[model samples]
Target: MKAIYLESINAPFVLIEKEKPTAGPGEAVVQVKAAALNHRDVYIQYGRYFTKEYPAILGSDGAGIVTEVGAGVAPDWVSKEVVLDPSTDWGDNPGVHSKEYKVLGMPQEGTFAEYVKVPATNLHEKPAHLSFEQAAALPLAGVTAWRTLFTKCALQPGEKVLITGIGGGVALAALQFAVALGAQVWVTSSSEEKIEKAKALGATGGINYKTENWGKALKADVGGIDVSIDGAAGEGFVQLVKVANPAGRIGMYGGTTGMIGQINPAEIFWKQLNIYGSTMGTNQDFAAMMAFVREKKVTPVVDSTFRLEETEHAMRYMEAGKQFGKIVLRVG
Candidate 1:
């Protein structure tokens, strides 16, 4: 088997041949077909959230076939096509990262390999409509968007949502999901090209984060948003807070713009606004999201595909924000 191994922080991934791993009890060995990049991978490479573990396989989202299942695993799992559910819990406990759970690709070996093993519980049936690459793109981003809107905010039809940072996979999924649910969606991106892409994807309108006052522009276009999905948590979160309707919700997920922010407690109090923080969703949420995708014909936005050996270049593309959507690595 060939796999990607990261030796240290900010280092290039090394492609090496290794022995294939077998499944353990209650686990399944996935013959990885495709793996996708996440901003979290960049952070792990930079030693942000994950520790520097040499020879680590760094990827969380993947789609593949179950080649082997260990003892105690259901016999029906054999040869089943599946995608991983990256989140361990739906927030029955507070905090996305704690001692309770760790996302794949960080603390544990990930799917950037010919084969990877995980608990059978993490596997979800892959929709026949999706190719291996597209299936790989959905697990992390799709699950996060699902938890943010459906679980955390309980976003409803006819409401308005402001989704920031248009090009990432999650933002695209959020926009598509909101639109599918009959919500009016507005998007923001620094790139005009990305803004146009968002509009073409059913966004009512969008603002170029490079030039326009997105917050004020959103207010003008939609009056105010019932919910603001802020993937970029820097100055943009403050603006997301600014554009929310009274008693509206702000779903804070990632920190593409950096984590720390200046937030006004008074506005939150006076407006009776609610802030919900979410990450990748629970197993149940993953199932619901997949069902929705299958039913609604929702397609994940895929920017590019690379062979497993090209993992290094894919990481560079994601870090540079050169890709419009998820950059995937076809493993086998």
Candidate 2:
């Protein structure tokens, strides 16, 4: 098999000949047709993520075909077109994942190769409306957005939404889902061009967060936000609160900007705000999200696509934070 083997932390992605893996019990081998990059892959490369182990594969989102099924797996799975659910071991609880929960592409081998093995349960039929590249972009970002919005915040059709950092995969997925659900959506981005792109995708309005007091400006301009979504949490997090309407809900999936600074207690308590910390979704969430995608015809935005061998360049592009959607690596 040809694979991008990360020999060590911070090593460049160099495709090399490697042994292809066979499926284990209850597992299946996917011949990767397309895969997508996430910020997690970048952090893992620099030894900045939870696991420092190297000599591993790094990828989270992929769409492909089942080539083989392991012992106890149904033979019928072979030749099925599928997208992988990157989240695993979510356990019985919906409110939180078990201690054993993990997103694919770290300690476990991932989808950055010609063939990758995953639990058969993680295989989902690709949404009929999506291409391999589009399906590859959907799994991780789509489920994260779905759980954060409808599951955590219970966003309603007529409610207003504010999605911070508009251009990234997860943020764009949330924007598309919210728009499809008939919500009035707003967004924030460092790039005016990205803001414009979000508008083209159905966002009602947006603001350049680089401006001083941009959140306050957004609140003033848009009246009040009924729901807010964020990934970067830093001193500026208070701004999300500033723009939120009373009883507004804010769902945060990541803290890329490090620890959040102080927020006014009154704003949270008096307004009865709900702040939820979220991560990857459960099995149930993944199924529900895929159904939503099928019903809504939501397409995962692709900023660009590169050949699988251009892994390093694609990683650099995502790290630059300049893309307006998911970056795909065409495999197979």
The best candidate by lDDT is: 2
User: What is the per-residue lDDT of model 2 for residues 1-332, given as tens digits with 9 covering 90 to 100?
Assistant: 88887889889988888888899899999999999999989988898888777788889999999999999999999999999999888888889999888888887888889899999999999988899999999999999999999999999999999999899988999999999999999999988899999999999999988889888899889899999999998966999999999999999998878889888899999999999998889999999999999999898999999988999999998998889899999997
> Can you tell me which runs of candidate 1 are displaced by over 4 Å?
89-98, 259-264
Which candidate gets the maximum TM-score versus the true structure? 2
Candidate 2 lDDT score at position 206:
92
- What local distance difference test score does each model get? 0.86, 0.92
TM-score of each: 0.94, 0.98
For model 2, how many clashes? 0
What's the distance in Å from true for residue 256, model 1? 2.2
lDDT string for model 1 (130-180, tens) is 999999999989989988998899999999988988889899999999999
Question: Which regions of candidate 2 fall more than 4 Å away from where they truly are?
Answer: none
